[model samples]
Structures are given as structure tokens and as C-alpha cells.
Target: LSDRLSRRVGMIVPGLAGMAVMAAVLGAAGWLPDGAALVTLVAAWVLLAIPDGLHRSSASALVVEQSPAPSERGRFMGALGACGALASVLAPVTYGFTAQAAGIGCTFLLSAVSLVLALGCVSRVREASSPATPE
Candidate 1:
């Protein structure tokens, strides 16, 4: 689980980096109004989702490239699919609550903090050694 988490942290950074930049740009430009804010929020979601779409395409290419033994490939893909499903179920709920409590701008800030924390762990093993162990 720790290894998987570490691997996912790597995957998340690129997308989150882009999100942070976008959020900063939008906030600096004073782009948030009720309707425009909602539109921007949806656009952010679509942008973030690009990584997932890329991952699926990459995974498909991997299966084709590796040409794994029949059963193993199916099992590998199935586990990957299950992990993705779990993320899909949990992420929106978590983000929705955070947005409700802190507002979307703060949510973006929180996400940036999380990304920085994740990257710091890579650079400082002490941080990586401790499990996140969500409360």
C-alpha cells in the first residue's frame, strides 16, 4: 500500500502542478463570479481529468507492448480499474466537503499544499517513512 501510494503521489504531481498554476492565474485575474466560477470549476475538473484519460491510454499501450500472459494481463488491468473506481468514489466527496468548508480557492490551496508535501517526501526520506494514515 505504501509503495502504491508513493507511485500515485508521483502521478498526481504533474496534474496538480498544472492545477495550481491555473488556479493562481484565475485568482490573479479576478475571474471568479457566480456563473464564471462554476464554469471555471468545471473546466478545472476537465483539465484534471486529462491525466486520467492519458493514464488509460498509457495502460492500454502497456498491455499491448508487454503482451502479457492472458490471465495476468486481465488481472492487472482489473486491479488498476478497481483502484481507479475507488479514487472516483472518494475524491469528489473529499473535495466537495473541503470546498464547502473552505471555499474552492482554499481547496486549490490545500491541493497545492498536498502536492508540495508529497514532493517533499521524496526529497526527505523522513517524511516518506511516516504513513499518511488519514484521520
Candidate 2:
């Protein structure tokens, strides 16, 4: 599903994923009541899963699209993979510590803010990379 979406929408697929992530994190951050929290958490999990799928499909395409040459692609992708691995390792640890200090609701709110910032960065990169047309 994400592969097809990425083929059509390209980088926008990840942008949408970022938005979904932000929404999910925000939803998980005490927006729902006690009885509804479980359902909301489940829905947030689904929302997070969408982005996970979209990212895996879209990131490779982005590597291909952004690399200046085929020879550079391997190095670019390697770096990308390393960064992803680092983030995966670090994020959970950071979230755990943050939750311990500030509580789960605040941690989720912080995650939502981080996603929003990431979306803004993606949008800027997209705009900068897009071709300019004659006036």
C-alpha cells in the first residue's frame, strides 16, 4: 500500500506519515479519557504504523532521487541506514528517560512536537529541491 502511494506521491508520502505521527502522538498525550484511553492508544498505534510503512518505502526512493550519482547512492543509503539505526536505538531510550522524568503524557507531547518539526524540515527540503519555473 505504501509502495503504491510512494510511487504516486513520492516524498509527500513521508510528509503525510510525519503528519500522521504527529496526530497519533498528540492523541496519545492525554487527549482521551480513562475509558477511552485504550481505544485511543490502539488507534494511535495504527496511525504510527502507517508512517512506519510509508517511511520504509519512501526513504529508499528518496535516496535514489536525491543522490547525485549512482556511485554515491550506496554511501548515501548507508549513512541513511546508520542514522535510522541510531535513531531507533536512541529514541526509545530517550523516551523512556523522558517519560520517567516528565511523565508519559509530556513525553508524547514532546514526540508530537518533534514530529511537527520534522514535517517542517521535510517541507523545506522538498521546496528547495523542486525545480523552478520561469515567471
Candidate 3:
């Protein structure tokens, strides 16, 4: 998708937002009654993978194209990788605690919140770094 277009942010944002929406739906499904819950969970699970894939691919492509100057790309990738590794190490514990303390549904809701916040951070960084255009 990124190869076919120039707007990496456009694709990345919607992909993540779609992921968040489906995650919220899945979370809400956990709170629904039996048959409805089963149906929703099935549907959401089926839909979830698409946006997850889209976000992963587009975001990675964007990182490559939008990261700092050429000299800093390696450092940037290293930092990004370190952050991802940290998240990998911490996420299971966070999810387990959150699940134990506040039902599994809450974990998805928490992830939705986190995704939104992360998108906001990305947007702010992109905006701050982008060169201003003349009116």
C-alpha cells in the first residue's frame, strides 16, 4: 500500500484507528450476552487481523521514509527496536495484571486508549518536524 501511494500518515492513521475500533468492539463483546457475545467476538476476531496487518506494514514503511536524516537512520531504527523490545517485555505483565484486576475486556479498552495516545504522539512529532509552508 505504501508503495502505491505517498501518504503514509494517511494510511497509518486509519489502519490504527480501525484496529482500535475493532479492539473496542471486541472488548464490548466480552460484556455482551451469550449468543451476541459469541457472534461479535467471531466477527471482530475475523476483522482484527486486516487492520493489524495494515498498521504494521504502513507504519514500518512510514518509519523508513519519514525517519530523521540518513546518518541518523540506524540510531533511529535502534531506538525504535529498543522501544519495541521494551514493550514486548512489559506488555504481557501489564496485560496479565490488567486482566486479573479488571476483566479481559478492559485490556482491549486499555489497548485502544494506548493506540490513540500513541497516534497522537506520532502526529505531534510529525507536525513539529515537518517544514512550514508559506501561506
Name the candidate that leads on lDDT: 3
Q: Say which prediction, candidate 1 or candidate 3, comes out ahead on TM-score.
A: 3
C-alpha lDDT (0 to 100) for residue 57 of candidate 1: 51
- Assess candidate 1 and give its TM-score to the true structure: 0.45
TM per candidate: 0.45, 0.73, 0.82
Candidate 3 vs. true structure, TM-score: 0.82
Q: Residues 1-135, candidate 1, lDDT per residue (tens digit)?
A: 222444234443344455555554434323466787777766766675665443345444343333345446667777767977998898688879987886656656666565556445433422234323322
Least well predicted 10-residue stretch by lDDT in candidate 2 = 126-135
Per-residue CA lDDT of model 3 for 7-99, tens digit only, reads: 336666777788889989988988899999999999998998887787777666556556556666667677778888999999999999999
lDDT of each: 0.52, 0.64, 0.75
- Record all residue pairs in model 3 with backbone atoms less than 3 Å apart, i.e. clashing: none
Comparing 2 and 3 on TM-score, the stronger one: 3
